[model samples]
Target: MSAAITDGAVKALISQLGYSSLYPPQEMAVKSGILEYERILVTTPTASGKTLIAMMAILKAVEKGMKAVYLTPLRALASEKYDDLKILEKLDLGGSKIRVTVATTDYDSSGNELAGADVIVLTNEKMDTLFRHNAEWLGNVGIFVSDEVHLIGDRERGPTLEMMLTKIRRNYPQSQVVALSATVANSDEIADWLGCKLVESDWRPTKLVEGVYEYGAVKMSDGSKFKVESSGVSSAVDLAIDSFNGGGQALIFAETRKRAASLAAKAVDGVYKRLDKAARELAAGASADILARGDDSELTKTLAQLVAKGVAFHHKGIIKILTATPTLAAGVNLPARRVVIASILRYDSDYGGSVPISVLEYKQLCGRAGRPKYDAFGEAVIVSERGVNAEELYDHYVLGSPEPLRSQLSNDSAIRFHLLSAIATMPGMKKPEIHDLFAGTLFARQYRSATV
Candidate 1:
């Protein structure tokens, strides 16, 4: 109930989206002038109404006859956001219909087809490619939104995203920037880099109960303990079955794809027996759909069988249980009532050994729990394998804060690639211009120097 939400267009948009009132984070965003085109950075837990805040700003931009560009770190995320924004197309604000477009492929073209789009969604790499191609439509974008903006700390893709934001800030100083992120440790530094009003909160619509699974019981952070019936398979499988018995879905994060498939295979019987007639029918349909894809490989057949039993791994379809690798943590908005981490360790090629995941990654996995409007509460459990201390798991992942985000733009290859792109995009750009452009990056801000 802020002044911004009182506007007719805003009210209509909210009602159209079937929301009776803004969540606390959304209200905080509005109070910070998000609808007024203020550059705002929102760092909150998942399912906390971050998308609604971006939608409000997009609506405001469309109202002024200016376009909005929504950027994501992954193509799957881009498609998800595009589908979410498609709802806005039904609204006619000031006699203007919002048109949404997604551009994640075909990097060679200038994206002229997107000129008429009111809202354009693109992955970070795709946006960088569009900038290189000098897409004319980009000039009309009044608002730039970066979903999963916390990926700025990532090693591989961080430099591109960091550079993209820096370029946007430098080239479009008047445009509004709305950065939506998961709860990260160094949110203030990122907000300062973008000159955005930092709105940080831990508020979630559904309560999140984090726990560590050891032996055959779960000890939650809230001082609660529950015994999980032994499935004779694994602790993670037991946790998933417990969730299904309570009329809830579960997402299990495995260390590898093979392990994910193995875990799904093990949980099939438990999950299948719990489904009712209607649920079984739906699962059968999903299984058939998977088989109909024409892959016909042994892996595909195994997956189809798992799907029929209301379980699957790495494959997308309707199922009560899904086991996947950590890649699913950041991509799409697939929530579950319970999230079971099968293993917190993954083999790293760089180190040639298993390494424990960061608290940020753990938070991302746990954030998948608790779907809004569906579950009253969510549970996240980390399974402690033999030789791994349960107390360490509890202290590091369940009770720890995420690490601070640092820039990955200082590397030679990243610098070279971005510098070359800058030179190619702006012909005859001298040293000072290049320096100025990079000076806007988080690397320069954090290091207190742009020495290149």
Candidate 2:
């Protein structure tokens, strides 16, 4: 209710939720002389009070009677965060006066309108393009929150985020920016872009241990090596099943639907293996077994019989298996005890075959470790077969510091599109200002390194 959040206010918010006091980074965030700040990037490990910090910023704006926009990279992420923010809204203000509205990028916003809300949640593509398309309404926005700010490193999607940030600042110079990101390699650079502060930390409630497992080659420190046990199911599926049996959840990352489905089928195989055979024979049990096992692939049928007893997989194709996954694996909190990567090589070339994953992609997938209540600690073990050289790819990139974030504006088309958006959003702003803002981006930092 106060213009500035007091320690008591902060304490009251945390106490009301029955959560412990804030983390050091969060405490610092709440008190950061934000009015003087234009853009702020909070870089912390997963589950490190990012949502709360984002809320504090939004609430501050709302208290001042200004509408704020929360942007995420994925539609599911937008929904998940929106739903969670709604709970806070109810707790703080009671009744759905509709303080928050979520606009999914892929879906229609027929039921709700973001144009008239205290807060709006949307994916980058939606709000970015929308503001560019309609510049008049940009004047009402007082705050903007960008979640997963580290995504600026993504060559494919980074332009949208960079353009959006530039668009807002150019459109409404007074609007405060709050960019939330996981622990990234270049937080300070991003902070400098928006002319805001950088709050960086490597703190996590849970510790993650990452390693490469060459099927039967390396032991898991206990001298017991994990065999790939290729179930004809993808390695990711196999790993998930192993985790569920060990009383843990897993998040498997797959780029393509086929890969996701194939990997999920493998996990479902393990689920099938665990079902009680006799229970599965009962009509309900049989149906459950059949559903879990999926098709009558002789091997699948046998796997289903095993599943009749208890096991299952998750991916796009296996509807039964998908139930076990986080549709939005990044921000979603369903932690898997063992998270696996199906394909590190994502893009295909007509002549060159497949392109290896960028460091950012690998980090995002690996960050799925230790999903909250599921495990005290999480394991991000890359699975490869014996004598297979794929392990080296991970060792050199994933297990190491990610390749530096790069600037996507290097592409003339990207620069031109951003230039158009900048003209629309921040009319009369000099071209030099656009370059500075874009250069302040993580993309520009990486681009500089590449050229150097």
Candidate 3:
């Protein structure tokens, strides 16, 4: 154990959280003086104690009579993190009670209700809106924790996240920043941009085995092989059945919501057949609960029917198999014993045809495999499509490294929106001031100020 972990408050918090000792990543963070206000970027595998590292930093901030803010890209993730951090409210830090709050709606307000909170969790957009509103309480925050920091590469939401970090680093230089991200190829660059120490690791609690499925056989990276009995429906459903028979749950990822729902509907019969009496009764109870909500729409009725048979689509619950679109891969901690990728290609409007998914996206989906404690090893299989070379698919998705993190701030709409936001926030700012503001961004750091 490090000096930071053995300290009084941290040790007590760890005991309360039921952790016997810090994992390797967490231990490395503590050794880097994270609790003493060190800025750090931790890039590690999923379920690798990254959240604990952030929690430790938040605890230190709260103990100092200052506030800590946690930022996520999605509302669902914000809710999940809020629920996780709520446990800290039970701990007494420096004789003051911890107050935790979450804000994901009403971005137009100044969020005065969050003024007294010791720890606040929010979606990235909400935090940006507060900055735009000039929320006075934000100046008192001692630490800012950004979860899933790798999303800065996304085309849709990445610009807002990049601008948020740029503003925080430039405006609040005194505050500590603890960035948490999945393992990416260019994490060192991101760390350099944040001026933080880089803590990268591949260590995970449960081993992950990557594989490719073709012709009813799955070839694993660890030199193992298994034949999935054909359910004559789909390879994904067959893989789900194989996983259930081996006494584990399966999560299948489809390219689209429609495909996910179709696969889940097809999987109901096979999953229900494998369920024991107790599981079947539980599934029926879940189905009844869904019906009790009284949506009565066709989609809800179909989902309720699927739940009764131990299957579901696009939502998390007690079920044997869950099929979801790639959106589920974004920082949602729904781990399973087996993860089957139904398709590696998705339709793209810009390209005017189907395009292969990026290696980073594939890795994100693979991270969901291997339930911690329940499965000794989790399997991630990419199904081979017709006319596509299986060897090529395996080489690119399973064996290749994930893509580097790049900034999307250069997009035309993003540039216009953020520049106007800067003008509105600063009021009477000049061109040089605007240049200086954006020059602090990761995009400017990567491409130089001339581009900005």
Candidate 4:
């Protein structure tokens, strides 16, 4: 049966993905010339079906017979999104007709240029490495999706991402670029760089109620509020957890990795408080063997039960979420109903993680707040101590828009070294031809915002 439908281009895309309905943002994004293989930047809330928009654009490009690259910042997010897309592919009418591949940056999966695959899901670094090694194959690259384009504003990772965008354009000059961001202040400057179109909106499906908790009270823009205990700063976290009991996930922003871990461990006090005389007596007498192990597996099982009732943590020690690549959180499928971030915005480590967080890192953590498929609504929040103001965090970092995107030096030895190899292998192709590739990017979008 031919799956061709005349009146419903969107219906076709949604049908292909097994999605029943398209959110307004999703529909608006697709209607914005994604079929033209034009570069676009979509600024929407987390869990607002941004992935669907990216996949929709890629599907159109695939139908036109082209290659597309999907890039994300976290190994966890990359893997998670890749899994979601793969599931959608299984339902694709043209599923078997399209070739799709996924790999991390360190993995050497680009040996054949991914020429056989219509869509390649990988991290930003992996795609950069592929383009650096071979520009010839990328001539077929129609769309380059930069999932967290705001990362280009990151002081550390942003530098690399910035350079990678430059290198990609330097390689596939006409390729359409899709820059997706959740929290950026200056998205238009980035749109102007590649000259395409901009779809910028701060609209979130779930209403986020920002609140500030100090000393003993939790106050929101709305009148409903609560109180934190007076354990100095720890009391603030306790109150946030209490907020979760009523409704809304509390993403506590801690200051250090240790602080994050501390907050995670401490949030379980409610559980501990429940294990009083009767509960403790039952546990002590009910299952000594299960209790003897005293390991994470045991604790996780216990915590999982608590979570089933409605509670959990999102941080490093209890979950190894900070730096581990492939454990469980490698792609961020955190199930916590409330998130507590012990603000690591500024580093305090012996190895010196002393630099203030770049815009990318800030949003990355904040983005974890809302999980669309799971909740009626969720909250993305920030917490600060050391006399640091919550409003200040929101004004400068959390609530502020994303920073503008910029180009890093593309001819850096690593990038140039690889493109040179493709040049040697391609017979006749100048770097300028590659530079022309960016003609379809957000770098060139004229409809960008004037706010920043």
Per residue, candidate 1 scores C-alpha lDDT tens digits across 213-271 of 98898999889999999968888999998998888989999999999999999999888
Q: Write the per-residue lDDT of candidate 4 for residues 59-175, one digit (tens) a residue.
A: 777766778788877776787777766643553444346667776766445447566766778777676666555645577878888887766654345545765676666656778
For residues 270-304, write the lDDT of model 2, one tens digit per residue: 66555454534552454454756567576556444
Model 1: weakest 10-residue lDDT segment is: 1-10
* Cα RMSD to the true fold for all candidates: 1.5, 6.0, 1.2, 7.3
Error of 4 at 438 (Å): 13
- Judge candidate 4 against the unseen true structure and give its global Cα lDDT, from 0 to 1: 0.56
Give lDDT tens digits, candidate 3, residues 160-181. 9999999999999999999998
Local distance difference test values of all predictions, in order? 0.90, 0.63, 0.90, 0.56
State in Å the error of residue 425, model 2.
7.1
Candidate 1, 213: how far from true, in Å? 1.1
Q: What TM-score, to 2 decimals, does candidate 4 have?
A: 0.71
**Which is the better candidate, 1 or 4, if ranked by lDDT?**
1
Give the per-residue Cα lDDT of candidate 2 at 21.
61
TM-score of 3: 0.98
What's the TM-score of each model vs. the native?
0.96, 0.77, 0.98, 0.71
Off-target runs (Cα >4 Å) in candidate 4 are 1-12, 16-20, 92-95, 105-110, 229-233, 247-249, 272-339, 348-364, 373-377, 389-452
Residue 172: error of model 2 in Å? 2.3
Best by TM-score: 3
- What order do candidates take by TM-score, descending? 3, 1, 2, 4
